[model samples]
Target: MTAESALTPTPAANAAGLPLALDAVGGDHGAVPNVDGAVQAARAGVRVMLVGDRVKLHAELSKYPGAAGLPLEVVDAPDVIGMDEHASDVRGRKDASINVAARLVKDGQAAALISMGHSGATMAASLLILGRLPGIDRPAILTHIPAKTGTVALLDAGANADVKATYLAQWARLASTYLKVVEARENPTVGLLSIGEEDHKGNAVTLEAHALLRQQAGINFYGNVEGGDLFKGTTDIVVTDGFTGNIVLKLAEGEARVLFGWIREALGSSARSKLGGLLVRGGLRTVAEKMDPGTYGASILLGVRGLSYIGHGSADARAVKNALLRAARAHQSRLIERLSTELSGPS
Candidate 1:
């Protein structure tokens, strides 16, 4: 496709009705969670095309007798990309599940691509197959963080480990647009993740990005935010390099697990504590549900010509189901078309 044509917004009527293409053989547990998730989503009326080894997929589907009545199709993808494989391997692994899934989106047979595979390979497939959106030099990954009041959008989560100031500025715009178009948050505020709240407190790159963001139109720049600010609900969106953002994401995940483990240990320490735990079990369950990463499902690879989402490598059936549902919702919302318009405007 020509550059101009690739940049043009795809009409919702043509792509919105397509089925979601899922990499059924690409997660930590292979087709188990993927098939279950596909069954769950299909049961909910979302059409899903599972791309992977046809035999394995069929065998898994057979485990769920009710799945036969659901809208689920399996496409043959005999190869599976390993988690340790480099993203470049996608070019050689012609029939890899993720590659096939991406191709389905590019060919208009799928509205979006969802994979719980090697995230690097998934991102590569999206970039190589679907191409980048207009005005986007490098696409970024966007993940939602549960905050004090609501969820916060964090971008460049792991897509670009090393980035230029311009990339950071662009990600802020992308994240803002995503929040507005998909999350229904109008004029969302942005925060530059840094060591301190002051504009001058960040490194040279952040300092430069801060100036550019200040001059950028349409977004509500909220200056700089510290690491703690993420859970404080300090801003609607947060922008950082993938290196730092990935570290922050990992740290947060680890901390949450440790904290919950401690809570469980403390609750079971004695009969008195056990009674207290039971009393607050309902409230704790609500909090836990909100804090669960699976609740958010997948991180969107924004700035792609087509919609792409990357879920956790260790994703469960619930997470996969949520990811498929989220992808369907995003396609129905005309997210890619809206994003094209957002990026095609003034820098």
Candidate 2:
């Protein structure tokens, strides 16, 4: 595929006149959130192809008023890979909902795909169907982590549990391209996740990776950053092995939830505080918007051939809709093409 083919054509329609393909049967709530999400995106002027069972999809689509009037299409792919199913074991099930949507994107029948299914399955399907980018061996899971200033790119979120120092180096290069093409950030700074600010704090791998990043040339390496630096906006991109990255991702998510819960409890402790809470509701909402991970949508699987996004398995309608929008944006911005080209060239 050519560089331009990775992006979704935005004028009138795509070359195949297709929209995003959503695995409408993937979420935990069955087809409700998926259908609602598709309706929401369509109402927002994005064309969508909800991929799932024919009869069930139409039934869900009919629940929303004016849904039929929007640019919505349905393609049936009835099989579903359960959340507990191992990705490798289920790879041959080409008829699975996730696999079907991936096939659509791979065959040029759709611009991009969004799935709130077994995340590993989604990643596996993307690799199995769409294949990897020319120079990338393993695809990294990249997501927009809400930061104190703006949002920082967190990569290798949960794709490969173990990666080489060379992989981390390549991740920095890909992240730089991602920041430029999709995020519009020029010359984004990168930081390696380590125990301390010192260059020699991490293990042998990180120590080696730090040296590699410093000499990587194209990307802006800002040396080592501690865990506290993630939300501090210390750097534009944070790179780490999938094991560490996944732990950090979950820790941040849980921390945010607990923090909000505590605040809510403290606010309702008394009438005086309740009034105070009411007064600060607007301010709190602004804070919530900044902290909510749903605002960032699905983790973009970089190094994959076509654009594939994986949403939370328990995603609600809002989260699903945001994932769809994120996928569309990545496609329109040609994130995959840029990463492929960047990695294909010299460091």
- Give Cα-based local distance difference scores for all models: 0.87, 0.83
**Stretch of 10 with least lDDT, candidate 1:** 2-11
Q: Which prediction has the highest TM-score against the true structure?
A: 1
Q: Pick the candidate with the highest lDDT.
A: 1
lDDT of 1 by residue, 65-103 (tens): 878777789999999899888889999997999999999
RMSD of each: 5.8, 4.2
Clashes of 1: 0
Off by over 4 Å in 1: 1-16
Q: For candidate 1, list the clashing residue pairs, or say none.
A: none
Model 1 lDDT on a 0 to 1 scale: 0.87
